[model samples]
Structure formats: structure tokens, C-alpha cells
Target: MPSKSSARLAALTVAAACSAATTLVLVSPAHAAAVRIHDVQGTTRTSPYAGQKVTDVAGIVTGVRTYGSSKGFWIQDPNPDDDPATSEGVFVFTSSTPKVGLGDSVTVSGTVSEFVPGGTTSGNQSVTEITKPTVTVLSSGNAVPAATVIDARSVPAAYAPAGDPAANNSVNGLPLQPSTYALDHYESLEGMNVQVADTRVVTATDPYTELWVTVKPRENASRRGGTVYGSYDAQNTGRLQIQSLGRTADFPVANVGDVLEGTTAGPLDYNQFGGYTLVANQLGTLRSAGLERESTEKQKNGELAVATYNVENLDPSDATFEAHASAIVNNLKSPDIVSLEEIQDNNGATDDGTVAADVTVNKLIDAIVAAGGPRYDWRSIDPADDTDGGEPGGNIRQVFLFNPERVSFTDRAGGDATTAVGVQRLRGKAALTVSPGRIDPADTAWKSSRKPLVGEFVFRGRTVIVIANHFNSKGGDQGLTSHYQPPVRSSETQRHQQATLVNAFVKDVLDTQKNADVIALGDINDFEFSGTAQILEGDGELWSAIKSLPRSERYTYDYQGNQQVLDQILVSPSIRRGCDFEYDSVHINSEFHDQISDHDPQVLRFHP
Candidate 1:
């Protein structure tokens, strides 16, 4: 049964579709009769009437956003066309506070334009909008248009179809296939009011008052209620990012497993950071799922527990030292050897030729001891100032934190920032030329990126070689919602080269001693299934320990809404062939609101 407001809104919609009488009279003599909102938003991503002036475009204002840099109101025509490829709603960019209120019937005169968020070179789809609008309120207090429902059935299973080769493999020129692909399905509803009911949160509420929810709750569901990104082809299409038009202080603080338990209605928008986002006008109440952090079992006396944690450019003055200390002590259970990445210089980003990190490493060490953990000592090669690519002047590099009581660091001094480490036969066993030395530091593959730090250690009676790495990030890659189909990942070229160098270095150690115990662990900055990982596991010389876990539990980092693997631990055949190792992706920070770091730590236990 439709309420009175619904019935009135339906009638108004039919009338608007049947007649453009109100707009035709106000149209200038130079132009033809006024066009509807759908006509301005053509079947393609770009509007056909772009850069042309449109007069007397009529619709009922559904939302009024008085804040933000792009202040505007969303207007939806009550009368909609039969084509699902066209949207009935469009944003009127007022450039100031909108005078029209919600439910006010208005006619606007403006220039039709396609606004590409974050500039045109960003590879994002353009948003169709009416800019510099002149509004004329025809009437007040009319019912707003009904919102289109989006659910599991409405969105397609496939991500997108193959793009036309003539258009350089970009999907921008193709017509919308609303029922065939999820990207097209969302594109068909761009700028229109849509609703999602009983959505499950895949990404926790971030610091910017944004979160992500999935319409399909059961689609590749992980044990912790996150969408598992196991492969590149199986992109979880039901995931949608959410931002609020209401007060930021009142927005809900939610975790990954929480549920938005009612109808959340909003206008679908296309942006640069995230592709298709729902800017919610009516946000749903949060329902907690009681998600908790994870902890791993302690290692035995004979077993060596090695771990990797990216401290996210940690310095001495940061307030998260105590939290990071607690995470290392409590969540990770204080592994025997921890490879810590992103340890900044003394002053941390103050560009004054400062390249040392003793202060930062000592601060973290002191904090760990204060948190009731073992007295850990650190070793690292200080990178040249501003040479490694991270926060400028931060001089971020890898540091090894070892518990002297459990393991002994084999320190053969003479390692510097540019000196490359080599393998040698020391007393009929494989040994490093210089402990805590950089691997192929002069190679171009490591240009402006952190080089791998190789160190030698003796756990019980056998020697172990460990390499710590932090490869180049995916900064310039096109997003999933990009206009180009099969988004290009330009960042892989350097990472592939980086992986090749590290793999060759491991081969050198094995060539010296066939059964040499070698473990390479840190933030690989690529997927376990990616080519980068395959290169690291070249010809079965090394095997990734992350594969030991089930497909659903392999993620150590969460981005957008997909929980994927970025950090990894790969060991030689000597360690992996035995199949006696234990691996755990400790979930301490990534899934929480008050996170100390953006990545989860990974630990591996093996007998050396």
C-alpha cells in the first residue's frame, strides 16, 4: 500500500514524464524546448549535451547539501524514462548555499558539464552535472521522488565486460549494460537516489567519516566478515563505499563486521579516491557484531618465531608508540625476530640532512620493554636522506628487532647504505659478507625505494639468513571503477624487478649451501598470487609461507573493502619441505577505528 506522499510523488512523476509544459515556456528563443535530466545524462558516461546551455530543466529537489567545497542540491524528476541506462537525477552545482529546500519543485537554467573528480588525468569517470544553475521554485512541499532499490539481485555478478579496442580499451564510449555487469549497474544509477537494506560493513568507519558496505552479504565472506580478495579476476562487486551528508560527529563508529540494519538512502556519486560512492542522506543505525582482535600462540623453545610489521613511518614524537608497543607485546606475543619497516629518522620528516634512526628505533625498543615484553635490540643500515621513497626527509628503512636471549645476531660490521651484501662460505656453511647489509643497493630496481636488508642469525645451533624488504607501492595504478577496463597497474614494473633481485640473492645463498635456511619477509606490497610473488618463489627455490593458510585467512591488509595480502613471508625449500611451520596473520590494527597502523602483522614459526 503506497502512502499519500508516495502516491502524490508517483503522480507528479508521471506528469513530468508526460508533459514538459512548465519548462518549454521558459526556454530561450535561441534554444529548443527544455530537456529532462535523463537527456542531459546520456546513455554513456559522458553527457551528449556537455558544454551546452540547458534552459528550464525541471525536477523536485531531493537533497540539499549546504556544506563542503562543492555545495549543491540533488534534483530528481518524478517522471522517469523507460530506459534503465539513463539516470533521472542530477546534481545542481550552486557554488554556494542552495536556496531551494527538499521537496521543492524547481526549474533550473544552467550549463551541462561532465566533471571529472580529481582532474581529468586521474583516470576516473566524469560525473554529469548542471553547473552555475539559476533556480526558480515552482512550488513547495511536494513529495520527493522514490529511491531505486539496490540489493543482491539488482547488482550483477560480473564486474565488467570487455571494453572496445577502438577506444583504447576504455569503457567510457560503450553503452550501459545495466543487467549484465555490476560496474554498469552502478553507473546506470549514478546521481539517482538509491537505497540499500540490511547491508554488512566490509570496511570499518575511517577517520574521514567514511565506511564501506556490501549488498551481497554471502559473496566471498571471510571468517571475520570481510570480503576476501583471493584473485584479481574475482573482484567483489557488491562492495560500495558510504559517506554521510549529515553531521560528522553524529556518524556511527563501526568495525568491519558491524551491520547497517535499516534502509540507507542516498545519491550515487562518482569520485576519484573511490569509484562509485553512496553519499547517504538517510544513514542507518549501526548494529555491532562484537568483532575482536586476534593473537597467536607462543613459540616453543626450539622453534624460532619470525614476524614482519610495518610501523607506518614511525618516529620518536608520534603518540602511537605505546599502542604499537602493546600490539607487539600482546597481539604478536613478541616474536623472536621481528622485521620492522618504515622506521623514520631522528627528527622524522624534517628535511635537514638527517639520515639516522637510532632515536626512533630505541624509542620503540624502550616502549616494548615498558609494555612487559623482552628486551629487544635493533640493527639497520641508515638510508641516505631523501633517497628512499616515503615521507620526504623521513629516511624510512628496515630494522631487525631480535631478542638476544632467544636468538643471536651475527654482526660482521662494515655495512653502509650503498654497500651490497654478498654470500660467502664461512667454515663450510653459508654466511653473509656483511651482516645487516643492503642487497644490490646500487641496482636501478631499488631506485627511490627501500632496499632489502639481509642479516645472519643463529637461533639454536644452526645458522639462519633473513631478508627484510619494503617494495614500491601501487600509487599510480588505475582504480577498479576507472573508465579503462582492466585497470592498468603501472607500479608492478618496479616491484617485479625488485622481486627478481631478491630472488637472485636467495639463489646465491642456496648456491653456496644447498640446504641453507633463508627466510625473506616484510611488506612485499603485492598480492601473493601476483607475478611479483611468483618471481620471489622462482623455480621452487623459495615458497611463500602465507599459502600455508586457507584462502579465506590469507589477508594481512585491507584496502577499500577487499581484504587482500600485501605483507608476506617466503622461506627456502629446507624450511617449507618439512611442513612443520606455523603462520598467523595477526589482526591487531587494520580492522579497528583507533588503529595504530594500517597493516596487520604476520608471524611465522619454524625450527632452524
Candidate 2:
């Protein structure tokens, strides 16, 4: 509930906007009959009357976006039709800034259009719009329509469209069940007045002045302040985006678990970024979730700990060394051997011909020692130029950092760039001829990506084979917010093959040594329920260590309002059979604005 002062503030703001709107009256002939905004918007992402000339489209101006190349005002029909499937509001593109006022009831004449925000090359969907208009102010001071309540109880529990969640499946064209599916629920409310109360913030406010929240907290949610993104099969459907349309200052900077305590009333919209967004102006007061940073348990003697971390492109230019060291040492507990992804070459993002990471690794190792961690030794093969995907010239690739005081790295001869290491069955046990060798480097699955780097390590006089990897990222995949009925995921094709090749290699090692004590870990860039994970865990030969934890607790990253897993560790059957392992996601990063990296490192502690 708003205080009298706050309520007075809201009234004053609305009054001020109406006063401004009253001053910008324009007169035009009302020769043609008026058309409702919903008729022009139709029921689809594109307007049914696009490219056609429409006259006398009348609505109250809801907002005026004066900045940006796509300057426009959103207009809504005060007397909306009884169709829940159609949008009552539409954006009127004025291209050049126009003298428009909020709450001004005006009659407009323009060519109906379907305008893409970033244009066609960007693959962004189009917005229903009225362009090249003739405007006439019909009236002023008319009350805005009441907001539709969209609280947690109002949202459907089921997210993602039913049937085939992927694009072009047999059931992709099935009719939407708006009452049950969240995608349909949001789509039905697109471009309409919608509001949510007492919502819990799900993601940190991003650079785009947008943040996600769950209107109603999921049941039995931990005091942790965030909700599980669940698996790919069961995405968090309760999430909603609140985007600031009037001012960036209006949107608060928040972390996962923070609460937006007041009501946010605005027009619902569909865009390229996220599926549905509430374009807001008068947002509610924020409530603190009281979440704190956490660190994992320390690794003790005889308990070998292995971990994976994505350093978020650390380089000499970025002054994140000590902070990263603190996270690795104090937070992640300084595992005996850690597989590091995205270790950049010297000079970082500079596209010079330099491929050496000696200085970069040296600085990080020095930072670790300075931060009371072990003096670590590292191993890696820098990628060819910018062939490895990441910041240009960063030469990002998988690297191994081992605490020599606790473990020894096996560095035999004959391993280099572009050389693939084959598994040898020596005395019925899997062994690599050369240590720190790439797996199937020449294979197409690893083209233009970081190839798996396998190495042997002796911990407490027992040898174990570990493979480090960073698979191709999900860059070009259409977002969940796509206007398409079911979103496309074209990025998975390559990853599926990459998984197959990796799985085959793992099987070879298992067949040679049934209890190989093998561990394959890094940022796989796919969900646990995804096909990529399925292939990697083929025939129960390898098991994802993160799965060892409760389903609700398995997350290494936070996106939107859902805590999800993007980093994972898969160990061989021998390790799973023993059941002596314990895994921790180490919530040192993510869920916070000030963190060392974007990803939370995962650790698996066990005796091999």
C-alpha cells in the first residue's frame, strides 16, 4: 500500500503528464472512420493490416519515448474490446520526435506497419505500429484504463508452450492453451495494461535497464531469495520482465531474491530480448531479500577436490586478479586441481599476433599465492589466433591449474597445437601417451571452438585422467521471448555432435579401464536435461556431479529470475558407483552485483 505522501506523488506525476499533454493539441480532419488499436494489432506478432493505410485510429497516449532512433508513443484504447487474445495498445512510430503528451486522447491517421526494433538483419520480430501519421487531439484529462492484475496466483504454473517446446516439431503448431501455458498467458496480454504486486526479483538488473521477477514466489522457496530455473524440460514460467520506458532511473538495481514491494502497472509487450515485458513508469517500492555471499567448504587432506571455473575472460587489462583469487581460494575452497575455462592470452582482447599466456597465468598464480592459496602450476595450449570463440585475440582455451604441493601434473612429451591424443590401453588401463593433450582436435565437432584438453595427474600416489572442455556457446539461438510459436534452438546441432564425440572418447577410456577414475568437467554451455547433457552422460558411463545434489539446489548460474546450471562436472561410472563423492556449486558469484565472475564455480570432492 502507498503512503498518502507517495499516493500524492503519484497523483502529482499523473497530473503533470496530463498538463503537458493538454498543451500539445493538434487538429486534423476526421473524414475517415476510426479503427480500434486492437484491430490494427490483430492477434499475432505482426499486424494483420500492415502496409495498409488506416484512418482515424483513436486512443489515449500512454507514453512518449522521445529518445532512441525509434522515437514513438504508445497509445491504448480506453474502451477495450472483450477479446483477451488481442492487444489493446500499439506503438505509434513518429521517427522524428513528435509533440505528444501522456494521457492525451487523440485521433490519428497513419499507415499500419510491422516494424522490427533492430531491423531484419538482427532477426528480431516486428512490433505492431502506426507510422507516417496525421494526429488530432480529440480530448484531454480522460482517465487511463484500470490495470489488469497479474499476480502470482493469476499466472499459470506451466511455462513454455505445451507439446513440442522446440521449433518445427509435430506439435509445434498446436493451439495455445492460454489458461494453462505461461507463454500463452503472456502472449494474450501483450500490449495491454498489466500489473503485478509483491513480486520477488529473480535476476540482477542488467545493462538494458531491465530486470526479471516472479509475481508470486514459488512454494517452499528457500530463504535463498531465488527460484530454480528447473531443467530445460521445466523452465520457470513464473518469471516476468519489468522494463523502464520513461526513465532508466525508475528501474532499481537489484540482485536475485530482492523484492519489488509495490505495484508496477504498465503495458505488456513482446520483444526480441525476453518474451514478455511490462513497460513501467510508476514502479513500487523495493523490499530487501537480505541475501548474503556464501563460500564452500575447505578441502582437507586425503579428500581430493576438483573444480571448474569460467573466469569471464580475465586478462591483464581487467583489474580482477585479487578478487578472483579470493573467490578461488576463500570461496571455492581452493580445490586440489581446478580446470579453468576462458584463460586468455597475454594482451587479452588486443588482436596482435601474441598467443602466449605465460604472463597472464603467472599473474593469476601469483595472486593465488598472495591470497594465502597454494602456489599453483598451470597447463594449456593457446588456440590458433582467434579461432577459439571469445573476445578477439583473447585466445581463450581450457587450462589446468594444479596445486603441486598437493598433486603433481604429468607433463610427458609430444603434445602441441592441432595434435589429437589417442587413448592407449596399457596393462588394461586407460593412459594417454602425452599429457595435456587435445581430444580429437582435428574433428569437426571442435571447429572454431576450444577443444577438450586431457591431462593425467597423480594425487596421493594414484593417477586419474581429467578432461577439460568449453563447448560451443548458445549465441545464435532464438531467445525464449521470440514471437515464433515455439522458439528455435539452432545452436544445439553443433553441440549434439560435440557431445557425441566427447561421449565416444569417454566410452573408449571406460572400455579400456572399467574403473578409470576419469573426470570430465568444465562449462558445457547446455542444460542438464538437454540433449547435450544426455549424450555426455551416455549409458550411465559418466554422471553429472551436480545431479548428485538435490534437484532444487543444482545451479551454477542465474539468468532472468531463475537459478540454473550452465557449468557441470561429469565423472565416470567408477566414481558414481563408489558414492563417496560430494559436490558443491559454491554460491560465491551470481545472485550478486559485485562478484569476481559471472559464473559460480562447481567443486566435486571424493577419493579416487
Candidate 3:
């Protein structure tokens, strides 16, 4: 004899508890079980578990979105475990909650429910409730002592058993088991906390900002052979400041080539280019610490060296700027003149200021200095008042960084100073002066939006010309209005027009400086097989440095799971020989969508 209202309330509570328990059982046991955002699509079991209750899921907050008047916030869970097939999901709304930013590791519990598609759905599935969502602070711990550092070469290969009895007895002088064994049997220890010790063969340390230490694994250790990761924020140079905890403590620091011990609490986050990165929350010293510096010679004449990178927008933030700058000064193949793209200008800056504000030019200089690159100097043109009508988007653009000691600019062209290039272009070009130079300013055989930045440099007594070009982006077009709009032919038209201009410019360079050593490099925003690229390479005026290699190794960018050649360095035949120009399309940006920029960088090296 219970009242109807009371009975209904009790029934709902029981259903919620049952649902939560069921979800927990279905989720994998390796980590906490939770609902993911990607999976919420259709049915409760199929879609991303919206309007369903889940428990014990762990992940880093990739993104956060808030609605009007403190209605709620959607937390994006980017845990690898939260696959679409699994229930661990996102779109968990919190009512009247504050706000959460990106990169925060959090754990949430709540009823998995569907959000109203366009805010129009019925039933409990429309908006689920998170009765007891809890977030735990997990960034503070003891710094791993420095004595345990290991090197990549010291660790032994992993082995599994082979099925053949006669062959299983011994493999590579080691005892084999009954089943087939893998030489590299290390996979599971990705995101777990562990301590490592080894020698550092390579050290990329930017002064007071970040340090990347690569240690070879110790021999016969239980862990697999690989590199160990260690990093320290410059703001916390003398201490460890865990971003999650918002607290700081005195911690030990280690230098490059220093044998040290350190603890890594989680799995190495692999970059798009197959680099295993360890995000360190704590670092300390061990016994018998010492440094080993090797003497290196400066670049001699006649060496064809060039550097290229995406720069990931080259933002002004301390962490991002330092990380990218360090990589350019250290991690790259070390070119003489670096052609860079995606250099950004602050929204309201009238001039290119310090790296802390206007990152496009100043930050590159700062980063080079931090990486101990004192021999390098650079120059750039700010597009603030350029008559070429400004770039399409008005934020991100391209620039260049060079080593003045190695090559000097004899003539400079392009930029906002004068619209030598047309108005439709985004990034203005420049022609630098160099030794063994071959630039003739009087030549007007080129047609471009933003004029091509061309320059001449001396290498091994031979003069070569370098042209840095950034064509119109495929982001939007005249009639299309916006990217999300349909009827996309307008975008195609603009891209085609941009390509035509680029092709004409390339032809013009070759026509003016016949048989001259020249290279065309930058983000073209077009694939190799596309019409734009074809036109540029028309009549064999330009040849792809990558296509010269095996077909299997020609991709420079990956988008939507499709790999394409967007960024390239095309070399004229004059510099193709004796100057075996090779391109290494760094796979850093395209692999991880979270990379600072959306494009992977292309590097070219020529040995004369």
C-alpha cells in the first residue's frame, strides 16, 4: 500500500544502480570504466553511452565546452581506452559546475545519457545525470633519482617461445620456449609509472625551459629496451610544479649526457613521428652524476644543408614555444637555412615583437638561443600593412629562419612592404641575398598572389637559389562563404587559382635564372597528385625531391587517415646531382591530431 509517487521514485533509483553496475562489468579491467563521447550516437549500447550511468573511468581532459548561464560543461575524455566500441565515453554534462580546461587528467562518474541532437530529444536518454562525479588530484610525487638512467642500446631484445621443438631449444644463443617468441616483446608498459636508469647519448636541453633526455635501457632489465623521458618546465626550473596539483616543491635537475635516475609515472605519449615522449611530474638526482660533452665542428663550405618545420603555429606560450624551438635547434637534421611555415602573429600586434608576444619571428630567435644555437640569426617581414590585401584567415602565416654565419641574404623581396605578389595570397614571400648568388630582381616573369620570397646562397663555392612559397589555403573560397557550408565548388575554384599562380611563379623563376640551382619549399596546401602541383611541375620545370625516392616513401602529410604530400621541396635538375637533395617528411604533426599544428614538416638535405 505504497503511494504511486513514492513507488516511481524508488523504481528509478533501482534502475540507475542496475545500469551503473552493468556498465562497470562490461568495461575493461585495466583502468577505471567510464563513458566516452565519441561513442554517443544512436542506441544506449551502441551510441557513446549517453544517458547511461558508468563508473571508474580515467582519462586526460582533451577539451571542455560550456553552455549558457552556467547550465553545464561537457568534458572531453581522450583516453586511448575510450574507444568507440567501448562504453568509456564523453559528453558528460555537469549542472551548474565551474569550468575545466584541456590537458587535465580527470575521473568522472555519472549516468550515460544521450544529449539532444540539436537539443531535441525525448526521454531519460536526452540528458543523463552524474550523481557522484569525482575528480582526483594525481600530479604530486617524489622525483626519480638520477642514478638509474639507461640507454637505448644497452637493453636486450625480448623473446617468446617457438613451437618447433628442435629450433626452440636455442634462438640467437638464448634458450627458446615451445611457442614462437617475439624478439621485441615489450608493449603493455605504455602509460604506467616506472623508474629507469641509463646513459644519455643525446640531450636536447633549452636553457630554463625544457629538457629532452634520451636514455638507452639497461641490459637484462625486466623492462623492454627503449628510451626514457624526462622534462622540466622553465618556470619551475629549480623545483617541481605539478600543473594538476597547482603546487611546487624543490626537485633535482639533470643535464644532458648526465647519467641520472628518474621516475616516470605514466606511459610515453608517442608523437606522430614515432617519438616516445615521457611527461615527467618529478625528477631528481642519483649518485655519481657527471656530464660528457663532445666536440663538434661547424659546417664547412660546399655542404648543402636546409631545415624545414611546421612550427605548430609557433605560439607565444612558454611551454609550447620552448618545446618547438628546442626541437628545431636540436632535433632537426640541422639545415643551414630553415624554411618555416605556420608562424603566427598576435591578434592585435602591429609589429613583430618579442617571442613572448609576436611569436612568428621573435620566438624562433629565442628558441634558437635556448637550444644553444648562437651561430644562427634570422629575419622576417610583418604583413601588418602589406597592400597584398592580407592573408585569408589573418592569423597564421609563414616565415623563415637562417644562420647568418653560414649564409647571408644579398637581396630580399615580398612581405607587406610592397604587394609584389597579388592580393589573393595569404603568406608574403621574400628573396634573401646569398654568396654564389643568382637572383635578378629585374626579372618579372612570375605571376603570384603573395610574391615568392627568393634568395641565393653559397654552398661549397657553388651559388644556389632558394624560393620559399606558401600558396593560398584550401580552407574556404569566395562563393562558399564558410568551411562548413555545402556547394564547395567555390573553394575548389580558389584553390585552382592559387595553384595557377604558384605554377606560373615557379616557371618564372626557372625562366629567369635558367639552369640555376634552385629549390622550392614550403606548405603548398595542395597534394602532389593534385592539379595545382601538376601545373607547378609542368614541362619538368620543377621535380619533387621526394618523388625521386621510392614511391612508398613519398607522403608528407596525413589528413582524415589519408596520407598526402602537402608540404614539399622541389629541386631543379641543376642542383639535383652531386647535390643529392633528400627529403625527410617528419611525421610529428600529422600522426597526433593534438600536435600544435595540423601539418607535418618537410626537411631537405643536399650534399654537394
- Candidate order by TM-score, decreasing, is 1, 2, 3
What TM-score does candidate 3 get on C-alpha atoms?
Answer: 0.45
**Stretches > 4 Å off in candidate 3:** 1-301, 346-360, 385-395, 412-416, 421-451, 476-490, 577-579, 592-594
Residue 67 of model 2 has an lDDT of 60
lDDT of all predictions, in order shown?
A: 0.87, 0.77, 0.41
lDDT of 1 at 182: 95
Cα deviation in Å at residue 76, candidate 2?
A: 0.8
- Residue-wise C-alpha lDDT for candidate 1, range 402-456, written one tens digit per residue: 9999999999988999999999998889999999899999999999999999999
Better of 2 and 3 by lDDT: 2
In candidate 2, clashing pairs total 1
* Model 2 weakest lDDT span, ten residues long: 14-23
Clashes counted in candidate 3 amount to 66
Every model's TM-score: 0.94, 0.90, 0.45
Candidate achieving higher TM-score, 2 or 3: 2
lDDT of 2: 0.77
lDDT of 2 by residue, 1-608 (tens): 24434543342222101112212355643454467887887664556788998887888777676665456677788888876656788777676566767788877777887655434433445567777776777666777767778876767877645334464332224443557777767766666677898888877777567788887686325457777866555667778888767677767888878888878888776555665778885687787777787888887787889999999887887799999898889988889999998888989888898888988888999999999999999998877787777877788888899998899988877888788877887766688878889888888888788888999998887778999989998877766655443556788888899889888888888888888888999999988878889999999878888888887787888876678888999999888888888899888778876667879999999887
Report how far off residue 355 is in candidate 1 (Å): 1.1
Among these predictions, the greatest lDDT belongs to: 1
